[model samples]
Target: MTAVLSARGWTGSTFRSLRTRNYRLFATGQVVSNTGTWMQRIAQDWLVLSLTNSPTAVGITTALQFLPMLMFGLWGGVLADRYPKRRLLIATQSCMGLLAAALAVLTLTGTVRVGHVYLIAFLLGLATVVDNPTRQSFVTEMVGESDLRNAVSLNAAIFQAARLVGPAVAGVLINAVGAGWAFGVNALSYVGVLTGLLLMRPAELYPSPRVARARGQLREGLRYIAGRRELVWPIVLVGFVGTFGYNWPIILSAFAKDVFHHGAGTYGVFNTLMAVGSLAGALLAARRTTTRLRMLLAAAAGFGVLEVVAALTPWFWLFCPLLLVIGLLGLTFNTTANTTVQLACSPEMRGRVMGVYMLVFTGGTPIGGPLIGWVTETYGARDGLAVGGAVAALAAATVAAILAFARHDGTPVSIRSAVGTLTGRRA
Candidate 1:
């Protein structure tokens, strides 16, 4: 019996978090909800392209969707710490659903305009400012710290898996019915997550202490991050990569239309193929027991290099395989950074720390998206991709060098240390 049970546990090790009832429910709900989310994403991007055949317009839409995170992301973290995360998610999710529904009505009624898309995207961004942090921190409540990394990896896997399905389905719907139907489906999909939240067994939750109300808590969170080299470095790296490296929606759409001379169906295929690699990366991450700084840095650099090479590929057939590699490295870097930051922070401060993480990661879109869009618009798609890739690789190298200097000095590295090392002075 002991041997049999041990074998069973080993067989289930990669999915250990699902053994917890709460995480299981959360994961199930998310699978459905995430699929819908991806569908809407594909549909929305296609809709913008249809409304205005400019990649710059699509970039603007992406930027608007993420702009609120820049403005309110940290405050969202404060709320995550102050309130019950599950309840917070319900409110945010509901708001997002309604927004999707409203957009669907506009599109289906033939009243949708570029202005309407921008308005709804901004509204969705506002909801996500709260939802992103709360949903990220809530994993700890569902599955304790012992299994947190696994749970995070599993979450990424679910998201990528949804990516595989959602885009394909959305492509078909967009071609046959309309983009509006995709939005309508996404609006309905929120019910699954909301229902799961309601069904959760509160007693089973591994609750962390709610942060006591206090002044300057946000500043405290910032100070905490400033002091931790592990947290600070990864966050900085993600900011650069996230801003310049992960503008796939724009890049892929440009490739499909301009380079490949294809339509929404081909765009969907690219996304789906990329997700295949992403899902592989996420599953691989799930098997790892720890997050390493070296792995994060290496993956980021590799992702950048891959993108650069992919940009230079002349044929769509060649581009597809390159996207697979890019997807794998991109997801690997993302999962490692997310797991590392969340695991490194104190429970009381995880929300705010993650808030900062999300801010740098998504908020940078406003700055990077338009710049990349302009590059693509002015120079061409390949040049735009190359620019982003070069910047991402350069950022990784800079962070890696700083980290090496810090290690050599046997201290947590900062800007001062980097400057001192460069100038040959004591830091």
Candidate 2:
């Protein structure tokens, strides 16, 4: 009896699910690769800003990087469903690594043109169109349903934890070694994730049966979401928050330099501080086994409200701490929404569901970044942040009202119970 009990206990260990070996390699590789990814992100944004000294140019670069996701994410989802994710990821990651290396070479040689940046940015965005859904869905293939939720939260935790370290390190590296070095590091970072994918045991992977690739697959994913009001509403909330509200950094970057009267080093510190709060939120999320809708709604509200306060503050010190709060609330909302949507869908539909999820969540950035950039350019940074927060808050409120009406009609999203799942407390 003791032997049986011991076996059962061992089976339930958190890392036990990773005993599959393939997942262990995948997770390990992701950690290293994701850190490099973050480093490049910091470097890329800084490089564009230094080259142009125009907020709109930075916004344009950001838009180019995400526009492909908006255009191709749904199709990417179909591919994820219809093909072997491992093979697809190998192709896409290789493309991205090459792009990163090329960009580093351009910048390092002092021959990088703005047009060159724009073109490469667009190509990178296009690759991400394939990469995002494939990667999101790949989590399930790696761990199966038994550990899917934990794996998703852990993925976010790992991503943001890298955020905690990567930006600060990038700041130091950029200041000391030049942005090209950061890009070079990013190119090398792809090696870790690529190696992990190569090492994963094919036999242990969850087999996704290929579906007939069809026209109107994006519509099918949309219709699947529409049938569930809960699912639709959270996605709506994310769309608003991601597109407009989450552009705080872009807005704050301008304000930090102009309104708050600071410099690049100060800008780096602000980002790092936000990462600190975001890391805390991600860690808190990792403790949960299941997710609910109400929690998502509440967190979305907090995310918007915090951004509003952060914008309204007059002093740099006051506003910076508020950005930290905004970061914490934003991650709580984002990670919860991400985990909930993934959990609510059927395993077979996960690729598509997550495809739309990534589309709305990330696709918004391109549209929002430029729009917010225009706002900052026109009205100044403070107004941009305030307006963004206001819009996001209004969207959240609208979704909440729609959700209430849906419940009156005898429909509620799984998110309705999200709060209880995390805290074991009822509102």
Candidate 3:
């Protein structure tokens, strides 16, 4: 009886966020849409590789896809604070659907060029700049602050589950029909999310206080982060890892073609395996009620170590399992950092805080993707992977040292205190 009760308790804690109807709706819709998004990502990367047969070109395509976020992500955060998030999501989601459809048409018509791919990628990035921060901040409305961490972890799980399914399906589709149909399928998947958004009951939402129009709001947000060590350290860690560590598309593409001599099917298998670990990590995170900086740092360091091990593995089979461990550690780090940052910020500043977070996390991709690609092309895929792993491990070590030194020096600085101060009042 005790064991049965413990099992039930664990299950309930793992899914507590789903008790909120709005979050349930959001999760259901995201499962479908996220799958479709992953499908497109796999198809797109494969298509780019096929067109140019150059890993560097693949890197360039990735750089273009995320460049807009580097430029407009902060302003996108500003818009999130100023506008209704649900309404904004509808617009962004619609535009993304249209863009996916356009890419599908281009691919099917046999008129697709590298330039066309580059342009569409850039446009999609523009939409993402607005979409990311709003979506990050929107969760508080669905489940309120009490359930925000659980909701975020569940969302990560949903995304990773989709990643597991989408790539495998995309690989089969790409192998059987072509990449065009995968894009078409992705375009249609947007309807699920839009429908979910439209169906939400506004009365059920716990709407956060919106900031009024004010000059220098962006600077205000920046200053808010600067004053908080908890926020600053996590953001800095993410920037380094995100920029140098997460260029998987480039790394995987090179590995698939150059190292493994495999086709799209093999590439998809690799992604699915990685997602398995990520999904596990997300579920583990969901079971916990709190986030910790130590967990984030340890996971980041583990992720780097695993990547290096994977790079050194001579056999494709050996390398694939290492990616699973890497995925687990990477997702654990990301979810912890994401939850910590969101919970630390005031609701009014959540949008901008998330915007800066997303900007640093993804914006660095433009610089890192191309550089990693060039490295893979010039040296080898293994060497490129090694470099990324080393950088991530070193970054984690650096941050850990800083935190330890501060603590040992009798500094009153603490993440708990930083969070208390940030969320205690509006910026």
Number of the top candidate by TM-score? 3
Whole-model alpha-carbon lDDT for candidate 3: 0.89
Candidates in order have lDDT scores of 0.89, 0.77, 0.89
User: Candidate 3 on 126-219: residue-level lDDT in tens?
Assistant: 9999999999999999999998888899899999999999999999999999999999999999998998899889999988888888999999
Native-referenced Cα lDDT, model 2: 0.77
lDDT of 1 by residue, 153-221 (tens): 889999999999999999999999999999999999999899889999999998778998999999999
- After superposition, the stretches of candidate 1 with alpha carbons farther than 4 Å from their true spots are 1-10, 409-427
Q: Give one digit per residue, the lDDT tens place, for model 2 in 1-427.
A: 1111222335544334455567667777777777788788777777777788877887898889999989888888888888889999999999999998998999899898788888988999999988998998888888887777667666766676677677777788888878888788889989988998998889888876666777887688789888765467677888888899877547756875778777656667777788778877776776677676767878788777777787777777688788777878888888888877777787677788888888998899899999999888888888788888888888878877765653433333456443222233332
Q: Sorted by TM-score, highest first, which candidate order results?
A: 3, 1, 2
In terms of lDDT, the best-performing candidate is: 1
Question: Which pairs clash in the backbone of model 2?
Answer: 230-413, 292-415, 292-418, 293-415, 293-416, 293-418, 294-415
